[model samples]
Target: MSIRLGNSCVNCQKYEDHFCQLHETTVGTKHTCDSFDMRAAIKDDNNCTTCSRYMSATCPNPKKAAPHMLCNHWAPQEVA
Candidate 1:
């Protein structure tokens, strides 16, 4: 998790709901910019370690996933 996280707000410490706490502006869950800082408390499925597939069973892909890895299959949970 040392590397920059996928340049995403959902994984940023500055993200507060739909707002960017750092920029003081609205943001999408997938929105990102130069200021993205990974959240320390992040345990969302965005990463392989927290992914349901990795937790419940082995990953189906040919390559193994790293802790901070993001894959094409990642789908954000719907906000309802």
Candidate 2:
């Protein structure tokens, strides 16, 4: 297998060496499988980093909310 990235083992949850831990078959980092489960480590879009209340005390929710956790407090981040 060659060192590769993108929608494949490098970004999948079951990636393990030259094979997928879920299917137990030899796979490459450039080839995605039907059972692909994206790794949680991949940065998500709906996050506190992009929220308008990211660093403000007015935000009612936790400061470090889950990557996809959003609430009524969500507002478009203001451009400086």
Candidate 3:
């Protein structure tokens, strides 16, 4: 799927695990696709709304501004 950052998150770059600098997820290879960095984490049944990592005001991902509304990129996925 083509994951385009909408106006909500257009102000930032695509989320990269390395951007956090304080935290990183283990990616298997360098040649992997863009979606490779998205890791599956346990999500609340209510989607990103009740998700701590998502609604967090302090998340390092540039797209933290993205809302909890239903979107193609809102699903929980492991970063490995």
Who is ahead in TM-score, 2 or 3?
Answer: 2
Per-residue lDDT of 42 in model 1: 53
Q: Please report the TM-score between candidate 3 and the true structure.
A: 0.19
Error of 1 at 14 (Å): 0.3
Residue pairs that clash (backbone atoms under 3 angstroms), model 3? 39-77, 39-78, 39-79, 40-77, 40-78
Cand. 1 Cα-lDDT: 0.66
RMSD to the true structure for each prediction, in A, is 7.8, 11.0, 13.0
Deviation (Å) of 18 in candidate 1: 0.7
Compared with the true structure, what per-residue lDDT tens digits does model 3 show for residues 1-80? Answer: 77532322112233344342223433323323333333343234544554345655544453644554444335343322
- TM-score-best of 1 and 3: 1
* lDDT values for all models: 0.66, 0.68, 0.38
Candidate 3 lDDT (Cα, 0 to 1): 0.38
Instruction: Name the top TM-score candidate.
Output: 1
lDDT value, candidate 2, whole model: 0.68
Model 3 spans with C-alpha error above 4 angstroms: 1-27, 31-46, 49-52, 58-77
TM-score for candidate 2, please give it.
Answer: 0.41
